[model samples]
Target: MTGLRPDTGRQAGTMLIVFGVVLLVSSLVVSAALAPSVGAAGNDGTPQTLVGSQGGGPGLHESGSVYLLDGKETKWKAAETDSYFDVTMLDNGSVATGFMDSGYEDCEPYESPCTHTGFRILEPTDDGGAEIVYEYSFPVRTRSNSEVHDVELLDSGEFLVSDMEYERIFTVKNGEVTWQWNASSMYDAPADPTTTDWLHINDVDALSEDRYLVSVRNANQLVVIERGEGVVEVINKDENGDGTGDPEVLLQQHNPQWLNNGSVLVADSHNDRIVELHRNNTTDEWEVAWAVYEAEGVPFSWPRDADRLANGNTLITDSLNQRVVEVNESGMTVWSYKTPYVPYEAERLPEGETVGATTYAVNEDATVYGNGDVPVLSLLLILFQTGIQVPFWFTELHVGVTLVSLTMTIAGTVLIVRDR
Candidate 1:
């Protein structure tokens, strides 16, 4: 067999590089051509929906914002911060939300250029703008996965906050932590909790004056802690008593809603579905009472929030899909709004996330669909990197383009090196 001469190899390498560039450019064009229509699908009466985006992606918190939509039209927006999480409109017409911002002097043991994570109250202006009227935030070491994700204004004039930095849930009254519950008391603690995302206790809600619901996301469990007592109950409690919860039940859930009838609604993020769990009074077990795997003819991709409206409809924040959809009990998309970025939580006002849901029978045989299969690329882009984003239209064609481009680029470099 005759070997390729240096000049031939160099020519082959150049041709391969050109092919890789062309494929990449063509893939982007195809992705844009297949993008979903960004508007409401049907007239289900858009009821003043508020959305909280967890920044654009990973460390790109500057792309985050809290905005209001009236039937796909933005009414007012609060985008002057780095990142935003849970959002709720207070009784006095002010919005209370969790936020993160960079640039602080007091980083303490960390260093300069730290981030501050806490809550802010925004008041709407007459000019269709919003202003931060009050804020209660503190500096932290890092920005990624270290912000307060949920905040609830208690009736006691205190703010219930989920502190992910220290893996705890506490209430702050006038800037002082009135009460706190640490997850290390239950889970196996790391050497220093703040250095890594351990429990990732992202949400805490007051069920009553003494009772609270805490979402321990990394542990795949939700906990009910009383003011005086520790964990009174644990949903998805471990079977072998290892403290690592049962993932088959919840699986890295977020923003769980405690229903009035002793049930719980959860955004099962890793599972890509919205599940409602009802506690069995007889067996003392939580079972999947209702679950919806798909809407608008597509399976959910990293859904982070689901709020059951008073009108028997469920509003879902389909995170990776970059849209919020309201679905009926039959799993049909009634109304939808395309968000500018991946949203963490959403609420439809006047009767936001009240304790209401019609009982639904679980359908185990229901077909489910998720983001298109691009196994190797998916793990790298969608699963690992927090800053990178994969479009909903990223189908097998895009996957093929990406794989071929990468191979050609690497092969071209090798061929050129041999010629040199």
Candidate 2:
């Protein structure tokens, strides 16, 4: 019996060593299979393959400038000092951007109650720089330049701007407010006097010549206001009357865009999702017809804007993730662009329109890759396919083996260090 015990111990130790070796081999195989593809998928000073293959033009140009909002002060100083709050590509190939001199800083030393906030329209020159054809300035009470989140150029040569501090949306034509709507009464003010940004109206879209769609972020609602009338319709309204905007469908949302079908697509920002609120024909109530939370198992973080493209796919600015992802109708990420700066909005200009010649260079050091020539989504799909097709037991075994290998590797390295 004593002799048998020693044999059993030796057998058990041998089995453990064998299992550890097998695990190491399996882990190496898995790593070899995945690592190369991922490394090759990086920008690596070359264009990446087009992801999702929706046939959307040349994707993002290799060295073209986009009308982007660089939200970070440090990064903006490194890139360009003319840091903007909102940038939009005009139909005429020009770009319009909203800028603040002090960058959301308090209006101090100037002695005025307003900060220097303004908009500029730049026309592309032959030398890859823009020519500012027009400029307009305004004073906002808030310390943050976020008071104006969007600027739209109308066919009538007017501008539609959102002012959050005073909770109002106004139109400026010929440097004057042609039309304006005050939403102060619709929202409850914060208890603290210092908190001037109460409603935090982050977006405004001109639905028609007379109507508009505005996203009240703090209210957790989208209000469609007509020029003459007050609030016409509210999406995600406080139906329960709890005063806290209870059961809020959209929590701290932004960029509510009106669709051709009379529905609205909103970036449900705080909820970390994009939702399309469709108006019911019978009940006249707005219902969520479509949503894209996590496409292809990739979740969004603080997405600020989402635009439905001409091809029916949704172009989203996954802000906190520092990336822009284009998801198809089936919720598959077909295209993505990793930006160096925190992107606040992403819009696909019409086929012929362009944002002119200003090109923001890509940061090669950043790991996330997209907007080049490589098909990253395809590689992820290969991994996903392998995961699904493999037998359950085999998959479990591979995972177990990989874990065992990892444990042994760590233990061995520790032992070697301890012995030394």
lDDT tens per residue, model 1, 1-420: 988875888889989989998989888887687665644576635679988887676655767788888767788888867889999999987889998888887777768878899999998888887899999988887888788999998899999999989999999998899999888888899998889988888888788877899999998999999988999998887888777677767878899988854588899887778888878777887877777876775567778899888888889998877789888877778888777777889999976666544545543332223332212325544642246666666645676688889899899988988988
Best by lDDT: 1
Model 2: lDDT of residue 371: 20
Clashing pairs in 2: 48-373, 48-374, 49-373, 49-374, 49-375, 50-373, 52-334, 65-359
TM per candidate comes to 0.89, 0.62
Quick one: how many clashes does candidate 1 have?
0
Off by over 4 Å in 2: 1-83, 103-115, 140-146, 189-195, 242-248, 260-262, 351-420
Instruction: State the lDDT of candidate 2 residue by residue for 1-420, as single tens digits.
Output: 334443454455455556678776766576556531111111332221111110111211112233422221111111232334456766676766655443443455344555555566767566544566886765555435234666778777789888775567888988898988877556655654235656777778777767788887887888888878979878776776754343335778877777744467778776668877666677766666666675434455557787777666677776545466667766767666555445566665442112111111111221212221211223333232222322112233465565676676556555444434
The whole-model lDDT of each prediction reads: 0.81, 0.56
lDDT of 2 at 291: 68
Q: What's the C-alpha lDDT at position 109 in model 2?
A: 35
